[model samples]
Target: MNRMTKTALVVATLFSASSFAGYEVQLDESSKLTFGGYFKVDLRNVNGDQAYRDYWIGTSTYAPDTNQTSLQAKESRFNVKFTHGAVTGFLEYDFYGGGGNALVSNSYTPRMRHAYIAYKNWKVGQTWSTFMPLASIADALDFGGAHVGQVFIRQTQIRYTNGGLELALENPANATDANQSIPDAVARYTYKGDFGQVAVAVLARTFDNNGVAGNADGTQFAYSLSGKVFTFGKDDFRFTYNAGAAGRYISPGHNPGDKVNTDGSGDLLTTQAYTVAYRHFWSEDWRSSIYYGHADVEDFNGLNADSDRNHYAINLIKQLNKQLSVGVELGNYDADISATNSANSDYIQLSAKYVL
Candidate 1:
């Protein structure tokens, strides 16, 4: 019985007798091993006219919530998937409980949102990315109002797909030092047809300034392009777009000394981003979407040193049956700080979900 438990009981008795040996188990061709989950509880109200500090939750100043309500568990998830033969595997867990821009945390803190392994179209570990084709400004419950150019960063990659092309090899999260010289490489390409889907990405990094100190001499290069489109009730309706750019190289003791320019002594910065979205379903149990995003950061001395951000969102989903659902979201953010100050923030959410 040892030997790895007899090879997992002979692979679970050959996948449960080849999943019923015939054509009567058509719940998507049986051979499945699935267990789903979803639970959300949120009631939030935030506002701002001036006070809005949350800098990823370090919150030093800026507090304005004339009508605040708190309770969170926004991401209570559990998912397990296994499909025999052509191979597939997945694991997901999130218990939501943390601060600093919450992605998931349950104090015991075990965050591995998804563990992957796939075959037949190849894939390996960590997920999300075929370059990330914008799904109409996606909103799986306003994870910070979506659209951070839609590339949810869960790296550790190697992938290939056919039937509309896809290729990837990524691992870019900025090697935050250990003798910095960053370039964790990342590449992506994707294309899917029927008038939708398109993606392109590239990242070569080194800007883990987390250790501050003259911002660690900088160095970052990023590029991205994203897409999505759909017209009329085919999948209900959709339209989406994404754009990106990031460039930096500041060596020379982090430049910036009122030196309005420099290229050899090193100093150049650029950051531009964009996202647009629209979706509508209004049937089969209702749906809705609307999105917008923008970012700009430029500084190479030209004293106007820049920084600007904006986001907008709207979502409503309802499915009240066969696993339940209800959601509502609203969002806003604006920042233009270094040009005579500007700040704004807004949020509202209500959610309920249950899915087995």
Candidate 2:
């Protein structure tokens, strides 16, 4: 590469559309901006005792002989990032805000997914929780892929990171009780090597009852260990193990951090969950993933709430190009209301996504 050729390339890039191919714009020497996200359309169908159109955990009324199908683009999202020196800001949104008539126009409202700013080792605002191992989540067409036992959440927080260590003080509203004077605290450490990556995170928080019924406040603690291990070629194994009071972190409507007893004392429920997934590549453009997740809560079963939850899914995805792909997934969700009662639903999803 000679100086003349290098200069020509630079000049061409500055004036050609390729310079902004990745939605990148260099405003100045010290500042740059980029925008990226994906647009996706999903065709889904469910069969069995559940009437829901999505992959939901927990118990529902057992409506036998029911089947439903839906098509939507709610998973489409957009994100923008700006970096100036040591400071960077990012904002993201998806169409899951839940406004629209499905039968009329299928219109939906955009909802915030992530809004945050990072300066050096500090991050502030809303984003994926430090407890979640985003890399270990399964690949599936459903929005909640292998979510039954997964620690999945996004909230406002102030976080600090050094190397693989992350510490955060997150919003406490997601606790079992709404009234609280303290934030949820989390600490995590991650390790990455040639084989794969692993992370361990712990969360501690206090839940308070605002004297509504004279209930006492309580403290809860939880932990998660997750990892992705590379196997042969592009194949890998992903897993997550969690213990203690998962509460809303595992997925709302299913697990509660604590329950108030007749004595007005909070009784923290012990819970455990695990998820395992494997991804195998058949060819350069073809891949398949299979995952299973299970969750159990001790002695906290309600008539309509599940004491146990399980999810199983398998998907085959084909990459059409650098920015386009399609996939199909089959999954099942089981929620146990009690020893003898349970709801089971099976779903199939087909999706196409375009990245930008």
Candidate 3:
């Protein structure tokens, strides 16, 4: 195919809801191998007290006049897949394992992003949680476009999917350090059509404090609703809303599942998060996206109780070709700890990505 045809094909594939993309090889009549992933580099700077991170985590406190700038390629990753008959195995990794030095030779560790096996309608091993709506995620230059207001997590599980319904039993230990006597249960249903797609998922988990004194444990539930609606030509709107005692599932490291009370009783922190994003294609090679996220936590046991945070991001991306793209994003974040204390920060990021 010609270069223009190749680019168009790649773009169309990316916009599709399917997860199969990349180079493929036929090892035999019934066996196949695929290699995929992307190399991404980001240059970012943050100004103010919100603290700088590869992505927003809402851990910044009241520190003022803080500023930092850095460049990193840790977001680059690759994956391998092997398929034979009705069975498939996939493995993927990224360089977010930390322990890398910034002074010289930024050597970082590679961490597993996914490792799973699929046979028939069953999926086993580590992958994105069923409660997360991947299709509702924002499209932007930031590592996590709506990091502050989304359910983002990955863990080992056994899942079964039939049509639009999905059921899974995931590892609960990853969500809490307390004694876990049962796995996390999740159920999701999605509806897809030419117009767009929508999904709803529910999660149930048990938190056990190992009978420790002054620690409380119990069972809690969470729910999420997400969808992507196509609008005008090549434009779409995506959104997701999550609520309940989601804890780490709400937004890794930002919202905790529960807190210990003075009397040793565990209190499931109530958390709610939501994100809305819109993407408009200026042309076949140009596009722009804008997104906003908000998160709230209540009934906590600290001075920062009832804390909340919000963030906004906008970006313009240019597709150089089928395998290369560049984008620039501007974002702002704010945290409201209490009426007497609040902090905010602004950031700008430039990123380049190449599909392998």
Clashing residue pair totals per candidate (backbone < 3 A): 0, 0, 4
- The parts of candidate 3 lying over 4 Å away from their true place are 1-22, 213-216, 260-267, 301-304, 337-340
Any residue pairs clashing in model 3, and if so which? 214-264, 215-264, 216-266, 247-257
Query: What TM-score does candidate 1 get on C-alpha atoms?
Result: 0.30
Lowest lDDT sum, 10 consecutive residues, model 3, at: 256-265
- Ranked by TM-score, the better of candidates 1 and 2 is 2
In model 2, which runs have C-alpha deviations exceeding 4 angstroms? 1-21, 58-61, 210-216, 256-265, 302-306, 338-340
Per-residue lDDT of candidate 3, residues 1-356 (tens digit):
45576566545556662453466665667876678999899999999886678888645566688798989999999998989999999999999998789788889999999999999999999999999999999997887777778998889999999999999999887444656679999999999999899999999988677767644478788999999999999899999999987877886666553454444456567789999999999999999999999888774536446767898999999999998899999999888755568889999999999888
lDDT of candidate 1 vs native?
0.54
Which residue pairs collide in model 1, if any? Answer: none
> lDDT tens string, model 2, 58-127?
4356777778898888988989898999999999999889877967887899999999999999999999
What C-alpha lDDT, on a 0 to 100 scale, does residue 23 get in candidate 3? 66
* Superposition TM-score, candidate 2 onto the true structure: 0.88
| Rank list by lDDT | 3, 2, 1
lDDT-wise, the better of 1 and 3 is: 3
Pairs in steric clash, model 2: none
